[model samples]
Target: MPDTAASKRFTVPIGPQHPALKEPGHFEFTVDGEIVTNAYVRLGYAHRGIEKAAESRNWVQNLYLLERVCGICSHIHGFAYSLAVERLANIEAPPRAQAIRVIVAELERIHSHLLWMGVSAHEAGFDTLFMYSWRDRETIMDVLEGLTGNRVNYSANVLGGVKFDVTPTQADIIRKGLTFLEERTKHYLDVIMHDTMFLQRTRGIGVMTRSQAEVMGALGPTARASNVQRDLRVEAPYAAYKDFPVQMVLDTRGDLEARFEVRINELFESYRLINQILDNLPEGELNVRVPRRIPAGEMIVRLEAPRGEVFYFIKSNGTDKLERLKVRTPTICNMTSVVRLSVGHQLADVPMILAGIDPCFSCNDRTVQIRQADGGAQPNGLSSLMSWEELRQYAIRKYEAR
Candidate 1:
């Protein structure tokens, strides 16, 4: 038996350099023997000041800047930002462009979710699952590269419409790729859900109750894991989401396993959505002309990114340069639950628990700083110091502004 009387609580740092996380984020755990009693996270290691930089850049230049926020979700970021600017400018993209946008967004979701699945599998010590998921992700990357020129950052989206157009042959290639992904993802889902070892490692671990998730403001699969039926795709339809209906997924268990299931299921949902968009793609001009001067106004636009609800607020003073640009990434909203979920879990499982949320450290790193409990101001990593209350107020103000 371990000698409890002689042992004192010790602090262990999980990252900023750990192998488990795909990107860098610092997690510190206070452990009494093997069980974690508390946890703390340090973010902003990757802050690029993209939002503040948007203020100086012209509306068109900001599209490229926003796309670089996270490589995996580049398309969604560009799509959402362009939609916001379009709303302010009172311009509508062609139906074909809208459908194409949806197709690309769904494809991006497949790539990102697959990447996360591989990373999460690695964190849980299942190298085989990691390899299989990552290997299959390449197929989707090839499809994206075929549609656009690049694999990772497609750079396909422009303000009025997409930069690239899919030829009939390219569309056929995409359809074939989607078929392959649908088949491969089925096997992946079976492995994730039915594998005894995976279930043992993830199920009932890092459990969060519905109340806890809501209070912590969890979003995406993290929120869905707790039976929260919130999805920006369904709630606030944008782009082709307005045309294609989105079915929100929810599970009541609120555990690491539930989140795993939700994401795995979403892969199939993405396939379905992509197929739908491709089949019903309309024939029209790909882009509409956007005027140089946007009317003086502010608008808040939200999109359902692979991670969760991504909100972009843009203000224009009838100039090329934006008055203010702000983005609330999904990782920022989900970071609050980290401390809550880490408590009472084994130190060995910390990495898996953290990865289960599919946290995006790079996106989180670009946060605004605020005052700490101490008199001096301190920077919070991966999230703004602004509370959810403050964010709602900011969103309302932007919507209300002329």
Candidate 2:
């Protein structure tokens, strides 16, 4: 029964355009006086039919296409996609290639997490922390550029193995960069944690209890903030992760500050992993030649992206063009918890609350459609699929017609 004593609430909408979020998304809040009673999120503003697009491209071409899914997670997508193809084609990359993949993955993690920390700080009106974190991020980017040809979308992965190889000289530069980032991150943490103003703004804001986090299926640092030890690298190791062990990080507070802390700590962990991979560099052929005719098979590969666990499923019909490619991004899992976290917070807290997930809207905005018997065309734009209720109705109709 509804509680009669509870006060009535007013609705407030936050962004498809706001200073807080870098991506386009919308949120609605039910407010009672100054406190939010409940919140709802609407996404899909940047969907571009990437999976469908992949089907049109051949396996080799899709490697570059998948890397563009999210700039920050470019390497992980390529890694997972290439791993799937490698499994299908029965090809094994050389040990040196595997180690180089590890180094690239960790460098991408450092860049991504540092970028998030800066954006989160900016959301909370802490400009100094934001500037410092972004400045530190360039070190990792430079290191990546020194190894891979490109800085943002490092098209390093090929069908059977990696395209870019790290030499001894490049390895030394990477090591120096990691050392610099490690020291800079320590100073960054001091500013974010000890600074009274930063803590006062972020602490206890956008709290999501452990149970709530689990029910909502939060992933990555967002779930880690709730004390859930669910790192895919540690739980279901793949690629170089199978060789190198990783310690999962967790905290029980489940607040904005907690999420911030986990990501900051992850940066240090990434630095350590990079150094370990570089010190024990393996020597072998970087790539193996794969046969033209791949066996007809389906495979699923999961990797730990900077944000959380990313899943990729690929099916091939013994042809260059894939039969199907499916991806489950971390942002999709964490969006559910975003609504819960936004409740009971002020309007000003909305941006910080959303930023707590360190969301990737482009990854979350994906939509795939098959033909329907409703005598209408499927919608293609991001905003059209933003409504969850509408998506549910579309799914029900699609199933019922079948």
Candidate 3:
């Protein structure tokens, strides 16, 4: 017999050259006419095996290697790994070094969010907004360049502490740039909220409930947009977050509009936190001496990367090199939510929904088959064939049985 499920739904393949964000992820959207019935994702187009590579490099060399994991949130990778190593060695970075790390990390956040805003806008065909957002983002990039001497992959971290200190002049420069960024951010927020064209593409699209977010392991603004309250910065407070606490920004709408609002609002919160750190800058050494070879231990470190929580598990055998280094980036955790949410929405709206997650395909370049059944669709293949409730229950049962 002809496969009824295959006949009822046709698959739409979205890229190794993706339509959304120009990323290297392959998404198969099974649609019945215009409405999407199911979605599946296949990654690994850009995986460089950074985790396995970290095992071969020494403690100092690993910092540089892991920093290349994501060009946008490079510093956070280094920051998280260094924290794990320091924890294993039972060493702490000085107050000054910790403060500087926070500064760069926050700056990286602003840079990443701005870039996301632009790309998401472009995906929705708001090219003018895209251009303006990217133009403003350059300000953060310039500040990062001045501070770290490289815009991307800033190797500002070392084993025990930071590689550099924030000088008074550099502090003034960062403050001035941030002040300008703050003003521009307000304008962008207002535009996104009020622009009818942009609103049409974003609002009410990709709706995810708080329960769904938790069940699917959504994190960062993706979860916060649904009012999930799962920020590592606010909840866990690693690095300097404890000293300069984050003011969580949330929305209960659980739609694309909420995601856009949460991220834009976070830019302001990040600005506030960065200023707080600068004003009460700590005094101490740039770096403490960490032993060339770390003591034997295993530790997990989590940090709020631009997308969400970046998890690093480090294992050492009392050697200069690590035994194993495992990295679970935010993109992988959030990909489940993206594929799940894409169902029952219009196929035209797929790009906006995909962009809403601010997906970093490169960071999540691992193969995953989220559903063992034929896609997320029922055999009959109308979107209503299987309700989200049924789908959720099926997922729960499948995983629990495992």
In terms of lDDT, the best-performing candidate is 3
lDDT, residue 161, candidate 2 = 78
Selected candidate, larger TM-score, 1 vs 3: 3
lDDT of 3 by residue, 163-241 (tens): 8878889989989998998999889889989999889998889999999999999998999999998888889988788
lDDT of the structure predicted as candidate 1: 0.84
Q: Who is ahead in lDDT, 2 or 3?
A: 3
> Which runs of model 2 end up more than 4 angstroms from their true locations?
1-9, 367-402
lDDT of 1 at 377: 47
lDDT of each: 0.84, 0.83, 0.88
Q: Which regions of candidate 1 are displaced past 4 Å?
A: 1-7, 367-402
- The lDDT, on a scale of 0 to 1, for candidate 2 is 0.83
Clashing residue pair totals per candidate (backbone < 3 A):
4, 0, 0
